[model samples]
Target: MSALVEVSELRTWFDARQGGKRCVVKAVDGVSFAIHRGETLGLVGESGCGKSTAGRTLMRFHNPNGGRILFDGNDITSGDIKPYRSRMQMVFQDPYSSLDPRLAIRDIVAEPLNIQQPKLPAAERDAVVVENMRLVGMNSEALSRFPHEFSGGQRQRISIARALTTNADFLILDEPVSALDVSIQAQIINMLMDIQERSGITYLFIAHDLSVVRHISQRVLVMYLGRGMESAGTDELYAHPLHPYTQALLSAVPTPDPKISRKKQRIVLEGDVPSPINPPSGCVFRTRCRYAESRCADSVPEMRDAGGGHFVACHRYE
Candidate 1:
């Protein structure tokens, strides 16, 4: 399969004033990865580790401070983003805030069509909204209702409908199921998978939950402090996580099987996440990594293929 989206050395930085000192907050620093067509690439990390920033940068919502963004082999970062708008779409985390309260559901879902595919007539637009709503398991009853009238899960379905209005095959799902209740999360996740199966859509699913990522993703990429710690196929990464951070994350995910649950060793990390504005030198995770040595603090680790295409950015991997 070919890459539907390719990001290389992507960086998104912000200027912040901390006690009168101007500093750069490296929200996403030098991140690189590729998303193949029809596969869900899960991006997992702790809070403020640039997962959301990377998603936004890929969607071209936040202009990258540095790096290349190629969408279907075209350089989208440097050129006009208008053409990319129709082919790619984003589903946000909060359904309540993402939708318009003032507009009816039909109007809300059709908003993207108005912006991205205005050539479609009103009848076609209505047809597209209806089909997408149905695809997301939303009935025609929701077409006339307001956002506040629906549950969290239903609102998220509406959000999904809006994203699909532009007929996008590539979606940036940024914490799409996080805000919902655990019971509701499964429905949304399952629906996303079903949609992918039917439409062959490619997704960059960003979430903090390792379990959720493992369920929906074909490959997983772990990030820390805006840097990619490791990336591999889903089962491979979980079974044998190379990076300390990846190991700690996987160890925390609760296993359902009794035997595995009993044998799993929880890796409890110490210390607070470093400030993005003034990150530690060398490996960003050295402060919390139990396997850290003097060499870990001397230089940054370049991502290298450990084996079988598993890439890890840790000195220990050598």
Candidate 2:
């Protein structure tokens, strides 16, 4: 199938005021990727690597400084996002902070429908909310309670219910299970998989955890300093990571078997991640990479087709 969402060289920058110096922080600088219909595209990176920012930009939460965002064959990089809000939804990382304490569970879940389709009857909207709640494994009685009354997992379920109420085909799941318990995380992940099976929703799953990304993603995109490092099939990327940053990342995912874990060669990268403001020349990840050379510093590497449909952005890979 063709891409449902196509983003080309998307850039979202922010001005930072540090002491007396003013500088532009490239939160999402020249990033590009696509999300096909009915597929989960995992975007993995370290904290403050602009993974979340990319997701928000795609959802039009932030006005991109440059490039285009095409959704469903139309350019939606500018103008009012209200028309597409219902078709695209975002479930935030923190369930506690995302939901409003003032509103009851039922009201919170039905908010999208109420905003987008205000003319709908009260009973009909309530039914739609309840059905969405059911899809996320939520109890009907809990709808009367506030967000604070439920557990972290339950609150997240309510959040998911709210996103689903609009029948959004594209969902940006930004670390949706990061805040929940391990067992609860599995439950939510399974629920998401079930939702995909039933509704064929396209997902841009962003997370720092490689293991979680591996579980639900068919394709994975690795990011560093707001730029895409590599993107390939989940198994392909994990088995043969082309970028050094990706190799270092995959090395950290813990293995279940004692023997395999013991024998595993962890690629411990050195140095702190460079700031987005005044990032290293040529390549952002070059400072910490072991394979950095004069060529790596001289010019930025473009994404190259590295056999078997895998794409990598590294001089060494090129």
Candidate 3:
């Protein structure tokens, strides 16, 4: 299938004021990737590793500092973004804050329609809203209720309904299940997959949870300190991670079997992530990497293909 979204050298920096000094926090720096039609590409990273920023940038919410955002093979790097808004949508991390508390579910879901297709008759728009609610497994009675009336998972479903109401082809799912209970998380995940299978919607699943991403994504991209560390087909990445960081990350995942669990060597990374304003020279992962050498500190390693669509960025790999 053809790419639905292609992001090349995407960068999003924030001008942060700290102690009267202005510094740029390179949230997403020089990232590049593509999401094919009807495919789920998982984005995994640490809390501050810019996974969320990358997702937001794709939606043009961050106003990218540099790079190209190609949607459906069209260069949308410079445009009003209004026309493309309907084609792409974001399911934010927090469903609680994502929806308006004062608005009923019907109004919440219909808001996107009002903005994208303002000329739709009230009855037609209401019909669409009710249909979308049902798509997310919500009932008509609940549509008249507010956000606070629902559980975390139900709220997320409502959020999904709102996003899908636009009939978007590409959806950015940012930690969509992180805040929910384990059972609820599974429900939401299954629901999301159901939607994709039915609508052929492409997804960029952003989260720090490796197991969840591994389960849902066809391909996975691992980020560290706002840079791409590794990317590969999901199965390949979990089986043989080329990048040291990727290996360490995978090692941290809990094994199901008791025999293997005790034998698995957990890679304990040392030191906290450096400030984004002044990231380490050369490989950003070098600071916490146990295998760092003089060569690693000399120059930034270029991301290169290891094998079979597995790309790694580390001097050791080179």
TM-score of 3: 0.97
Question: Residue 83 lDDT in model 3?
Answer: 83
Q: Candidate 2 — which residues are off by over 4 angstroms?
A: none
TM-score of each: 0.98, 0.98, 0.97
Residue pairs with backbone overlap in model 1: none
Estimate, for each residue in 54-159, the C-alpha lDDT of model 2 and write its tens digit: 9999889899999999999889999988889999999998999999999999899999899999999999999999899999998889889999999999999999
Per-candidate count of clashing residue pairs (backbone under 3 Å)? 0, 0, 0
Cα lDDT listed for each candidate: 0.92, 0.92, 0.90
List residue ranges in candidate 3 displaced over 4 A. Answer: none
Minimal lDDT window, size 10, model 3: 266-275
- Cα lDDT tens digits, model 3, 214-301, are 8789999999999899999999999888888888888888889989879889898767778899999988888899899988888999
